[model samples]
Target: MKTLYETSLKESLAIQKRVIGALLMREIITRYGRNNLGFLWLFVEPLMLTLLIVFLWKFLRADRISSLNIVAFILTGYPMAMMWRNASNRAIGAISANVSLLYHRNVRVLDTIISRTLLEVAGATIAQIAIMAVLIAIRWVDVPNDIFYMLLAWLLMALFAFGLGLIICSIAFKFDAFGKIWSTLSFILLPLSGAFFFVSSLPIQAQKYVLWIPMIHGTEMFRHGYFGSSVITMENPWYLLLCDLVLLFVGLAMVAGFSKGVEAR
Candidate 1:
């Protein structure tokens, strides 16, 4: 029995691996092929944005917000935002976008969403890491204080994204108008995500409010991993983890319920 179970697990993993690679390739071309720079822009995009934000903040504010380096602040914030926003936004339309592919026996709708999210999130992450490396090379930022926390933060961020995506996709599948609503919601959360500022600097009431949102903690945890725990407030990791878990299950339940409607058409 153990051997049979192990064999099935291996086969499933192999299939998932194939799906991951194929989707990554397809996404690279279809998503970036039109641009002259192509995948190189993967590095260029985050670098430019981080530089721009840091420059603007420098000129506008005229001093560092905290002991943290200005460049590092922008660098961390952008990719964390990108991970959450892109993953959830892309996922919101995953089912409808791939509905045509659903006709193909081999293209499972869930795989399509997961693959696309992974490709996008992975590309953005690599680009962010590369930017961090270059900045550190020039002494723009410090080395990652804890590689484990950095990775753990990324995992939590990805899970939070995937979990939220599942819920959004479920809603969008039922109400086509939800696509617009999702975009609107992104704008609302953009400032609240604390991409530029440290969580400690916020008003006490605001910190309490933001703490309830998992992405805030996810971003702070990630920054803490890199800059040391001083960068983010010492919030309860389990609380954020619990929120992530609850939202994840909610997303899964929504997807399960809406999946039948997906097949009816």
Candidate 2:
């Protein structure tokens, strides 16, 4: 009995993995199409946005903020923010758009959200590396001082984004109104994400409140990794991780319940 149960579980896991892969491929083809830049736009879209922001900042604020490298500063923060925002936005109504896929027993609601979030994360990561490589080669920015720490912070941010995306996707599935409301709120939230400024630079009282935002911790920690001892980072990785885990758990439970409810109908 135990052996049979183990075999069944393994088979189920494998099938789910295949379903996710298929969904990923379908998303790429459907969204990007088969020709004329096609999938390359994934990285290019974010790359272009980051470069535009970098240039705008360099032209507007030529003086470095708090002795931080302007190019490196924007590179670290903007791309990550884009990833978080894009992933969450794309996740809204993801299930409704792919309702046909849900007809397949293996293609769960969470899988749809996961596949889209992964695409956004992967594209943003590649675009970040490409941007950094080009800037470093041109002597516009130095390589990160603590690469591992930078990556850790970035990973935490990505996980946080994924959790938030999952939760938003689940909510949007049930309530169409949520999609529009979230779009407006996300724009308002972007400036508060610590992408363009350091948390320590804020007034002491403001800093205390801003630090409550998990993305701020991730962004500050990422900047610290790049600036080394020169920057003051008010980040607690454990706190960010805990928040992300809670969001992820709740998101998954909500998605599962929703999927079951839909299947029943």
Give the best candidate by TM-score.
2
User: Would you estimate the TM-scores of all the predictions?
Assistant: 0.87, 0.90
Span of 10 residues, lowest total lDDT, candidate 1: 256-265
User: Candidate 1, residues 181-209: lDDT per residue as tens digits?
Assistant: 88889868877776766778888887777
Name the runs in model 2 displaced over 4 angstroms: 1-6, 34-41, 44-61, 64-67, 263-265
Note the Cα lDDT for every prediction shown.
Answer: 0.76, 0.84
- What is the Å distance of residue 96 in model 1 from its true position? 3.3
Supply the global lDDT for candidate 2: 0.84
Residue 172 local lDDT, model 2: 86
Pairing residues by index, what is the TM-score of model 1?
A: 0.87
